[model samples]
Target: MCDLMPAAQPAEKIGKMKKLRRTLSESFSRIGDCQGSDSLIKPLDTIPEDRKVQRTQSGFDPFEKPAGQVKRVHSENNACINAKSSSSGKESPKLRRHSSPSSPTSPKFGKADSYEKLEKLGEGSYATVYKGKSKVNGKLVALKVIRLQEEEGTPFTAIREASLLKGLKHTNIVLLHDIIHTKETLTLVFEYVHTDLCQYMDKHPGGLHPDNVRLFLFQLLRGLSYTHQRYILHRDLKPQNLLISDTGELKLADFGLARAKSVPSHTYSNEVVTLWYRPPDVLLGSTDYSTCLDMWGVGCIFVEMIQGVAAFPGMKDIQDQLERIFLVLGTPSEETWPGVHSLPHFKPDRFTVYSPKKLRQAWNKLGYVDHAEELASRFLQCFPKNRLSAQAALHHEYFSHLPPRLWELPDMSSIFTVPSIKLQPESGDSIQVCSKSKATSNSKH
Candidate 1:
């Protein structure tokens, strides 16, 4: 009986063990079937048993790996962990690696506390001028503030001016000291001249003496020669643009129309110089003109200074201007200007009878010359090529017997030496006077 009881117990133990094993195998099979047949089950079952065990040991949810292991898995995963840690912890968001707004590359003007704005000087098509002083340096400078919002072309004009001025060092040209660019404005800091040739001539009233004219013209030619040597052309050369220092020195100002002449394939339009000072070639529709254009302006200025009025002031329209020119210089024929017949607007047969005696009488009437015949003969040349160059005109016998030092004009020391001159508001009275002179000069031309 004892032997039979031991055998039965063994049989019972084997049956229980087999049933337990069968139950686990069926559960695993069911789990595999659910995972293979359903996407949800597959995703949920992706977690490895070891990772689940680690999560459980670390008190983390078993659906995800432990935080440390997940962070170590990939750079993006690590970044996510760090972000979460920073957010939950007492740390602020990480700063990005970017350039600071206050870096030196940013544009800023004179220290706000130092520069004091003075009165407005002049307003042009693109900018306004003011006279300001630096409290820090106690220096007076012409402050040209450009309205970036209103200017149409590329801001590179200012950049080019600054860059060009940086390389140029000349006494006869305006000096640029500093450049300031803000988000909305561009400022050019320059050495200011107290007066321009037009203003000085106005103040003098009777017009410059022949000797004074010689000196001014000499300096003008010298400045132009220097500019031309540097491959720069002052496209706009007029009396108003020529700044005269209190010391009697002449310095060319307003480089907005200046350009480096070395560029290839360049052909400038004829409308650059003011109409009164424009050359005939320009009027005839020539674009590939050279330094000779500037010579024509110098000639006009020469005559104006001598006569106290514009030499060749034209009419309102091109036809009127042409008539005025022919009336003064006499109708240009193929004899005087070989190429005049071939000009784009040539009208040789449309001659207006020129009375040389009447023109001479008019020159005398205007008090333009003591010897009207000699002066008129020299000045009334019709062709631009026949006109005198600035340098050649400087050496003319007109200045031969003048004082040894022709440059010694009154208050000569103050001419261009002013560090800064405050720009005053233009009085309507002064403008009227200037306009009147301009008109009279045009009629005479």
Candidate 2:
């Protein structure tokens, strides 16, 4: 009877082993049943009865193997699990889904508390300019705070301006010190410049001093040349965008409309540059432009600096602007501009055939300085290709009187650093004061 009892216990043990194996196979079947389970997981009937009794007494999981054999069993189980997960339809519900890398980390070196805004300098369509002082080093800065749109986030203009300014390091280009980004706003920190050319001109209106004009134009060209050499075009070049330091250092600013030109030129938007400073070619509905597009604006600014008034201050539309330009530079024809007839806006009968007037006649102040009219003519060419390049204009006879070393200075060095080169005082008072005096004199007469 004792021997029969032993035999009955073996049958009972085998039945328990079969039940454990079936449970394991059913649990892993969802993960494409572990292929090695048949060999790795053994029935208790195969183990020595004494060892089985010891494992059961130890309270170890029935499905787990000894510690020494545990690693291999888990590895085989993982292989089948991974295979099932790789199939689109067989993904395990227990699999964890990891997220992608987060957006670009915030600037490590710059923070909002680094600068304190003192006063509001100005406001524009998308941003507000404030005069700021650095909390870390006690230096002044111009903080341009651009509001982020709920739907759009950061404006492309701000991104474009920052990316371009980061690579451009020169005495004539505005320096971008740091950028502070937040959930509600994006702030661009810049070296604080006292005033811009437009405000400076308003302070002393009857034309800037010839020496001052020369200095400003030189700096403008210097900056333009640097950008042009790198295939960049400052699509907008107005007096308001040119910042003037207290020491008369002219730095180009507001590059929101600027873009890099490729080797094979592509058509660009024609609706750039203020009407008063826009070039004839662009005003004539021409989209294919180059660095010359900016040269025309440079010429207009040059004339305005010498004359104290916009060269073509059109009060109306594109036609009025073109008419103002034609009145001075004469209406263009195939003889003057080989492609004039092909321009979208050009119509022979639509424009008056006015003979070209000498630049000195239109802006008498150009006649006040030697070589000034000639340089003005070179820039105000009716044909886009005929305009002088910023680099070439820098070497023109109009700038010949400047110190020879001005041409040889390093890219980041200011021309003011040259000995004896300084800003000359203006001869006239502010425009308002001059206007009041003129009105009083006329009333007395």
Candidate 3:
């Protein structure tokens, strides 16, 4: 029995030795694949207890590998150490790059302690206008506060107006000083104008002289020209919307209905402007129109200024509006207005004419007799194509005799005072006066 046991022990020992050698060989090959070398020294001279145990269990040696393999493993191990060092070093600077502070995306509209709320000026579809003084600048400014608790229509309109007015910078357009957005309210700060054309005409009573009328019309045209050039359409143009300063400078206000013109055939919904100033094309259901629609309004305003009343004040219905327009300017035919028949709402049967004698009588009532007959005729033309441009009218012989300096009026900064509203340090409230700033900042990405 002892002899048999000794023989079995020798066979078992030999088999165990062969298995250990094969395992060591396989471990060396795997270490080579991982680019680890036996001869490569570790960063620390002493091995950790866990590492020593792993080496003993895996049967790894530190000096038996080929020189080429050792060099390859050393290069790979160095690269890994260098990569770890580079990664740790760069992390903080990369984090710091994005940590730099930036200005808030949008300014707060109204801070509670900013402006001293004054009396209410007026109320529109969107907001209630107020006369307020800015605590910071100590200037009096018009404040428009919008209540968002109501229907969304007015708030949206106010936002659009604020967005557009923020970028517009012209003599004839109203200036937007600051915008305040509170928890449930939006407020707009504007430069205060003395009165609008409606009130101005009412106060004058006798109607502006033809020369003054011409001057006002010229300024109105200039404002319109600027707006049109910027691809903006002042959908509502009337005496009410035309604000006049104390020095009689005219400014186009109320951009709730105003829109930038880009596409060719964008049809706005019906009933944009007041009936009296609405053009023939607008009344004929022509939605896809051009700046020519505004020209028609210009003609209306011109005639209203000259006559001391609306030129074509129509009744409630569209047909009545059409008839009133034709009554004053005479009916338009295919020959008179080349595309008259093609209009969306064109109906030849509804055409009629008031007495020419009565029409002339109305013109005389408006005090247009002293001016050149051709001037009135040109302005009163029914066709949008025939209407005078703001620039052309400025150069008309009517204004030629006036001083050239009349066109270059006093600086706006001198005439009007802008009020600065104070804001809390963390409130992020500020005013953007120029249109360009408003456009770039307010536009959504």
In angstroms, the error of model 3 at 320 is 2.0
lDDT of 3 by residue, 96-153 (tens): 2111124443211233234566545544443455555545444555566665553432
- Cand. 1 TM to true fold: 0.60
Alpha carbon lDDT of residue 108, candidate 1?
23
Per-candidate TM-score against the hidden true structure:
0.60, 0.72, 0.63
Say which candidate scores most in lDDT: 2
Report how far residue 289 has shifted in candidate 1, in Å: 1.3
lDDT of 1 by residue, 233-341 (tens): 6666767667765456677766655555433313454556656666666666565556667776776676666555666655355555566667776777777777777
TM-score between candidate 3 and the true structure: 0.63
Q: Give candidate 3's error at residue 377 in angstroms.
A: 3.9
TM-score-better candidate, 1 vs 2: 2
In model 1, the Cα lDDT at residue 172 comes to: 68
Cα distance off (Å), candidate 3, residue 340? 2.1
Stretches off by above 4 angstroms in model 1 are: 1-114, 149-164, 264-266, 349-380, 402-445
Model 3 pairs in collision = 109-180, 109-181, 110-180, 166-435, 167-435, 167-436, 168-435
Judging by lDDT, tell me the better candidate of 1 and 3. Answer: 3
